[model samples]
Target chain A: MEALLYNLTYGFSVALTLENIFYCFSGVFLGTLIGVLPGVGSLATVAMLLPLTFALPPVSAIIMLAGIYYGSEYGGSTTSILVNLPGEGSSVVTCIEGHPMARQGRAGHALAIAAIGSFFAGCVCTLVVAIFGPLLASVALQFGAPEYFSLMVMALTCASVVGGGSVLKSLAMVTLGLLVGIVGTDVNSGIWRFAFDLWTLADGISVAVVAMGVFGLTEIIKNLGDDEIPPTLLQKKITGLMPRWKDLKQAFAPILRGTAIGACFGPLPGLGGTASSFASYMVEKKVAKDPSRFGNGAIEGVAGPESANNACSQTTFIPMLTLGIPNSGTMALMLSALTIHGIAPGPQVMTSHPDLFWGLIASMWIGNAMLLILNLPLVGVWVRLLKVPYRLLFPVIITMMGIGIYSLNSDPADVFLMAFFGFTGYVVVKCRCSLPPMILGLVLGPLMEENLRRALLISRGDPTVFFTRPISLGFMIATAVLLLMFLAPVYRRARKVAPAEEEG
Target chain B: MRLKIKSTEDFWAGLIFFGIGLYAIYLAWDYPMGSALRMGPGYFPTSLGAILSAFGLAIIALSFRLELENPAHVPWAFRPWLVLCGTLVVYGLMMRFELGFVPSLMTLIIGCSLAHRDVHLLETALLSVFLTAACVGVFIYGLGLPFRLFWWSY
Candidate 1:
């Protein structure tokens, strides 16, 4: 406890610096701006701004980048409230009640509740990190290759299950992602696996290129292809930024429940903020005295999912901070950012660079506070952003994406790769395949393979080592349980259908 | 009379996965597959290829069971596709030739305007100049990238 307080004090000293504060403010400001704009998400915005961070101190750079994340979460909820369009996947749940509330001219109430709930969740999660992060780091210090491999397997399985599509299709996407991940040179053999003689392919496809393509360009193309222009924002005047006392009372419990659920799920690999929000929404619906009110401007609906999403965003840093594992595509990008700054994230990050670790925690809290202050007063300004049409905005976005990819390594090949993935991503979207599993698979694949090889090397090629070790065995059991939970219903339904077919 | 593909998504998705899996297996065929105790690079790829093909087969099987809500048609928007691709290719070619940022950006904006139904030449031209100035200001002057504003600087 003393050590945590001492480390956190040191972190505050670093984060409280004038320059660091400036970076945090700027990052959140820009993050909120892009997040409020439909068709552009925080992931794309972060990818675009990644190059600018190359010039700053690593601590400031990471702090600013992280601020972009939470700031965008806040802004994403704003868009969900004012417009039916979700700024990102997690915010999709928020739009159910949030947009309905907007249509009913209670937009201000929904926006205020979202901000309040998110701020509360953010504060609690920061405390959770301060207390539990160090403990988890100590636990991670005991992990070896077998345990790591089992953990990745469990994460991948859980990720695929929660992805909410055909389980087979999600697994296929995961496999494709793993294959894509393997396109770079083989680390052990010094042989290129799938480079196909191109020097650019030798280094493998970059995360930024894939993310921008899948999320940004693909989204624009999909929007353009759709026959319908997006519905315009509710024209009613937003009244009463502060909710009634009774409404706040109703929301308080759901907010707390959401934060708890999100914090629990956040540290798990593969299952991220999106899953947590969805889970929280379900819980809120089930627990509400009147469950039917969920989709019809229920304050609890907006409050619960928004809080859960924010809490999940904060707690996700736990695994990344302690174990050097990313829980989602966005976290993968943050991990890449840390690697670019020459800081390897894992157990050693805390012991080796205490200030960077604690400073990041402190900066997040400050950024959340800034977002709350900025969101309420400037809600009107962000709503006006909805008036901007798709045609004018899309061209600018493409230009930015082009320039961003080029700036990464001054390689036009990256741009071409991005365009290729963009088209492919559009096709994948049309086919109803989820992108998250593929992304998670892509990020986790090489790491899992590296660990599997190391484990095998240590066990002298004993495949049974994973089953033999206690931690690895535990993780494998969890994976089995998750798979059965997800697949059991399908099996039951298939059996019933078979009987019906025979009788017919 | 014929075995028809019931689900277009599954058919295409399965085909793509199966093709990629086969290609992976073929690529890794020559790599040494050492014993599991001393695994070679080929071992993992081969295993993954087999697993992927299994997934493909599973999906393809499901295509027979699952019915489509509507017979799938090509989801392509030809004009947007052509204009977007053309603009990107032109921008890339210009960058490859070391054309000035202004000209390249103008080409991109003008080309992209064709994707929309209502194209105002005056508005597009104005948007081009504005966007070019903004890009130069932010990317070049603000971020201080190494790219020269004008090609003639060489």
Candidate 2:
């Protein structure tokens, strides 16, 4: 306890620096700006903004990137409430009750509640990270090659099975991603595996390039192809930014429930804010005195999912920070950012760079407070931003993407590579293959292979070494269970019916 | 009697995966595959390739399963697809040839705007100038990134 407090105080000292604070503010502010705009997501925005952070200190760079992440959650809920358009996947539930509330001239109330709930969740989850992150990191430090390899397998399995898609297709995408990861020169053998003789292929395809192509460029193409017109903004002047005392009282319990749910799900691999928010919505509806009020303008609907979404976003950093494994595509981008800054992600990050770990946690709280201040009184400003037409917005977004990728290495090939992946991404989506598993595979593929080789080398060709090691065996069992659950007939039926249920 | 393929999406997806997997296996065949204890570079890729092919075959088999409804086939949006991808390729060429940053950016914005049906010439022109200026300010001046603004600047 003393060490944690001392470290937290040291974190505050680092985060409170004027420069770090300014970057944090800018990150959340920009996060919200892009988040409010329809058709643009945090993943694309972070991928685009990544190059701009190259000049900063690693700590500040990560701090700003992290702010962009959670800040977008707060921003996504705003659009969901007012326009009934979900800015991010996690906010899709907010539209259920939030839009109806807006139609009733309570847009201000819905927005305020969302901001407040997110703020509350952010505070709790920050504490969750500060406490659990160190413990997890310490445990991870003991993992050897076999354990790490097993853990990667478990993560990849969870990502494929729980990622909500045709498991076969998702697994294929993972295999393709692994192949893509193997394109660069092999580290151990000094042999080029799949470079196809291109100088650019010698160094593997940049994860940023893949992210921008898949997330940013692919999104723009999708929005352009979409035939539906953008949703009209609520024209009424929003008044009464604060909810009544009664409404707050009703929301209080849901918020706490949401925080608990989110805190548990966030640290797990393959599950993220979208799942947590949906789970919270279900739980809130089940617990409500009147279940019919859920799809109507229920206060608990907005409070629970919003809080859960924010909490999930905050705790996602735990796995990435401690284990150096990213659970989501956004987290993958964050890990890549750390790598670019010459910081190796893993258990060692905490012991070696205490300031980066704890300072990031402290800064998240500050960023959330900043978001509340920015979101409430300035709700009108965000609404105005929504009026910007998709036509004008997409062009600017693409231009920035081109410039961002180009600036990364000043190589035109990177931009072209991004374009190739953009087309591939579109095809992948059309085929109903989930992109997250592929991305996870891409990032972890090289690491998994490296560890597998090391473990095998240590065991002198004995494949049983994986089963003999207790930690490795535990992970293997978990992987088996996950795969079994995926393959179960009941689960397969549920997966098929899930889309139709969501539509209804 | 013609065999009816149930899910077109799954069929195509499986074919692509199968093709890629076979290619991976064929490519890795030449590399030295050492013993399990001291595995060579080829070992991982060869195994992944074989596993992927198996998955591909499984998906193809599953596509034959009875699906209740015929999924709606949305036609590919080829116009936007072509124009947007063309814009990126052109931008790459411009950068490759050292065509000035402003011109390259102008091409990108204008070309991308053309992807949509309703394109107002004035709005696009003004947006191009404004965005280029902003990019210059943010990427070049603000971040101190090295870039040639115009062909002459080179």
Instruction: Give the number of the best model, judged by lDDT.
Output: 2
Q: Model 1 — TM-score against the truth? A: 0.92
Worst 10 residues of 2 chain B by lDDT: B66-75
Question: In model 1, what is the error at residue A37, expressed in angstroms?
Answer: 1.8
Q: How does model 2 score by TM-score?
A: 0.97
Clash totals for all candidate models: 0, 0
User: What does candidate 1's lDDT look like per residue over A400-454, in tens digits?
Assistant: 8778777888877887787788778877876767776777677777887888888
RMSD in angstroms between candidate 1 and the native structure over all alpha carbons: 4.5
Give each prediction's DockQ, rounded to 2 decimals. Answer: 0.56, 0.77
Model 2 clashes, total count: 0
- For candidate 2, lDDT tens digit of each residue in B1-154? 6566788888888988888899999989987898899889999999999988888888887887746366666667777777888899899999998888899999999998999879999999999999999988997898777889888895
Q: Estimate each model's TM-score.
A: 0.92, 0.97
lDDT of each: 0.80, 0.85
Model 1 residue A219 CA deviation (Å) reads 1.6
